[model samples]
Target chain A: MTGLLVGLGRASLSVFERLGRGHLFLLRILLGLAALVRRPRLLVVQVWSVGVQSLLIIVVAGTFVGMVLALQGYNTLITFGAEQSLGVVVAKSLLRELGPVIAALLFAGRAGSALTAEIGFMKATEQLSAMEMMAVDPVRRIVVPRFVAGIISMPLLAAIFTAVGVLGGHFCGVGLLGVDEGAFWSQMQAKVTLLDDVVNGVMIKSLAFGFVVSWIAVFEGYDAVPTSEGVSAATTRTVVHSSLAILALDFILTGLMFN
Target chain B: MKDPRLMEISVGAFVAIGLAALLLLALKVANLAQFSPPPGYEVKAYFDNIGGLQVRSPVKMGGVLVGRITNIGFDSKRFQAVVTLRISQIYNSIPADTAANIYTAGLLGEQYVGLEAGGDDTSLVAGDEITITQSAVVLEKIIQEFLYSKTTKSASPGS
Candidate 1:
């Protein structure tokens, strides 16, 4: 009984310690972000690496998701003789839920893991130590640019995902299924609104998710042990933790914004 | 130098496309063209049960959307739902005595307010109440009625 109690206490203490460290890490990343205003070149390069590189996957996946949505929604809506609302279902599904959430998940997997691996590699190779010896704050120099790029790129990526998704839905619903093209577009237009669905749901969710994803990526990379296996393990943890965080954050943000 | 220039150009185009995508989304979502519609006037309608009618549901006149429902409230005294609609000034020609109905678009779809023109020449201005209204048809209530009548008819076949 005593041993069990001692073990439980140790677990709780370690959990609290980890939480405290995570909080401090976030604070430093925020400070680093504030310092990024003077480092526009760094920001651009990170955006190129993270955002530009992730574009094709975001677009292709977005289109396929939208196409599937159109096909499935048409089948379901036809049951009640309400096939005319395929556009509304497709648009709302993408904009309110799928667009931001899926984009963030993909970003977490693709860009987030990449950021972790690159920074972890730097740490493993003693580059981070070399930077520290040169009086450079690695957080400010390396982590901040990636974080800022993520925050800006997420919403853009989500918007692109949704737009392409809508077009894909249109293609399936109108082009293949012979759903009236005008009705499909007009019904979608008449229902979805910028202020309610797009700005709050898509834009805000992406921003929050972007911050969380990059923060996890950077923190995992920064805290990694300086060994080859350790760096690889950190990379894996970055992807796993970032993806879970994205999904959990998506749920929380959706409830907060729409509810 | 040339590689960096090409990268920058690609980055620029990427950002531009994303921005363009946002623009298209906003346009489609708002149902606005390049230009926005002018500010509109307001009107009110009452219903026994608004059912699933929501704020921002389109207000249509003769199959054309002229406005949107701005607010939904309860008239406690009359035990009815009060819906306020903001009609665009371009569609200010709705007769003063016109009636409104809460209509679902395509079966099982979103609900909107459909206005039926009365013979009166004087058009409704801001804050006029559309007294005559048909509330939303709740399917459960409809099914209950259908089942009840069927059972009653079967019980008394000669009648």
Candidate 2:
């Protein structure tokens, strides 16, 4: 029992140490600089991969979630004869919570995993080493572009998800469930405010998620041990760690901002 | 290697365009006029419960959104929720004796403030407090009350 306790303590300490590393600060600065220096083609590929590629998944998931929210919210309100407030329920839930967080998670799973794998592969192939020998900073060259791309794409994708999700909720709640269309829209217009909550929430979540994803990918790639096996392990760790971190950070930020 | 410089420029342009598009879309959706309530018409209502009542929750009259709940807070003195509503320009003529009720939508939907206009010809001006108010009737409490009443009735045979 004592041995097990010791092992657990050591393991937990290592995890916290990894999380508290200062490299992430440097990585953020490097990413910003690279984004400033690099031009068109890098940007296009980043946009295409991060925004365009992830579009379909975001739309599909957002729509369904919206539908479910409407169905559940509408049913609950109906018993109390407040069916008119369905619009406010749908709008506030989507804009404040679901839209940004869900979209970011989807982006992390899709683009974020791919980024980790690609960078890990380059490390395995010694391309990163070659860049180092050539005096080209690999962090700036490879990691920064992806980082900048993520930050830019996340908010745009979140907005798209929100708009589509609201429409989907409308279709389910009003079209299928027999809610008055005018009442739905009017309540939505009355309830959703831009500056105080919705806009601020979306922006903060997207940017933080982008930063977390890129940092994880680069950290895993840089520290990958061996050649092939190490790279593979790093790739897996990148995906899992970044995804979990996004969720954990989301809760913390939400408490700080909303509660 | 692909030119990092070129990539950066393209990404910057892409982000700029995307932000612009989102701005346009937000403008179209928000329709600025909707945010502006009438120049001189505010009212306060009290409720026992205001479930799911967000800041922008509508104040409706016969299913029309005439105003919005601008603020909600607990009134320690009254031991009720004090809701401040701003009526739009077109809805500036609400009668002084209007009754406000805390209402819910479908089961589990949102809660809102519903207004019933009185027959009085005097229009309510800004800073007026709504005297007639109905607190929300929670479904769970009603169910519990009904069950207790049924048990009590069954136990007593004579009365």
Candidate 3:
């Protein structure tokens, strides 16, 4: 009984310690952001790296998901003699579930991992230490801009994904399958509510996911030991941890927003 | 020759694309675009049972949609669902005795208010009440009734 209680206490203590660390980390990143106001180039470069570079990948993946949904949804809906509602099927699935989750997964793999690797590599090369030696805080100079860029990029990536996906669905459902174009668009407009699906479900969900993925990424890179293997491990851990955090947060946010 | 100004263009383009995507989603998927009905008039309908009826249900005339249900409410005193319809000015010929019925859009999909034209020469106008309205047929209730009737018929056919 005493052992179980001790184990429980240790778990709670570790969780509390992690919470405290994350809070302090966020505070420092905010300070770093404040320091970057004079030098806007740093922020712009990070946005270019984090956001602009990821566009093609997001678009291609979104299109594939949309086309696949049309093919699959058509088959199932036809079984129920509801092929007309293919628009609803594709639109609801993308906005409510796939858009945020898949976008975040891709973001984690692409930009999030890249961030971890970049930061970790700097730590491994003693560049961060050198900056410290020069009386320049590495966190303020390096971490904050990347964090902000990730936050900004996520919702944009998700929006582009959803838009391209819709077009893909339109191509497959209307052009290929010969479903009425009017029905495809009109039914979607009639049924899908703006505030419920887009604002709360897709946009809000993706933003939260963005914060989690980037937070995990930047933290992993920052905390890594100064070694080549440690840097590589940090990159790997960034991908794995960010992916998991995104999915878990997706579930929680979906429940809160939809229900 | 990678100009630093190249980034400015890309960033601007990115913001433009983001806003455009948002506009498209809002217009197409979320149905926020004002497909503005060219001026309209309000009409009310009362139903004994609304079933799954909701606001924004399309008001169809002669199998063609002419307006939308703008509001839905429960009238406790009347013990009925009060539905407010907004009919397009383009479809102003609806008679005074026209009947409104709640219908599923695609057999089993979303519900809408479908209006059936009546024989009265007098046309309906703003703030008019559609006295003749039929509520939606609940499928489960219909199935249950069918099953119950079958059991009873098999048990007591001679009567």
How much does each candidate deviate at the interface, measured as C-alpha RMSD after superposition? Answer: 1.2, 3.7, 1.0
Off by over 4 Å in 2: A1-17, A20-35, A38-41, A72-84, B1-33, B38-159
Write the residue-wise lDDT of candidate 2 on B1-159 in tens digits: 267666556556656655754563355344445555556467888877876687867788998868888899999998989989888777878899999987886555578789999989998888889988888877888999999999999989966
Point to the candidate with the largest DockQ. Answer: 3
Better of 2 and 3 by DockQ: 3
Winning candidate number (TM-score)? 3
Tens-place lDDT per residue, model 2, A1-259, is 9999999999999888776653764546564674546564555676766676787898799899889989999999889788787877887777777887888888878887777778788888889889999987777677667767777788877777777777888999999999999888866765556664456666677678777776776667666774788888877888788879888988898888777
Model 2, residue B77: displacement in angstroms?
A: 13
Candidate 1 vs candidate 3: the DockQ winner is 3
Superposed on all Cα atoms, model 3 deviates from the true structure by an RMSD in Å of 2.9
User: What TM-scores do the predictions have?
Assistant: 0.87, 0.70, 0.91
- Candidate 3 off by > 4 Å: A1-19, B35-39, B141-159
Q: Model 3, residue A20: displacement in angstroms? A: 3.3
Give per-residue CA lDDT, model 1, range A177-213, as digits (tens).
9888877987888778787788887888888889888
Residue A194 of model 3 has an lDDT of 85
For model 3, residues A116-178, the per-residue Cα lDDT tens digits are: 999998998989999999999999888988898898888988988998998999899898987
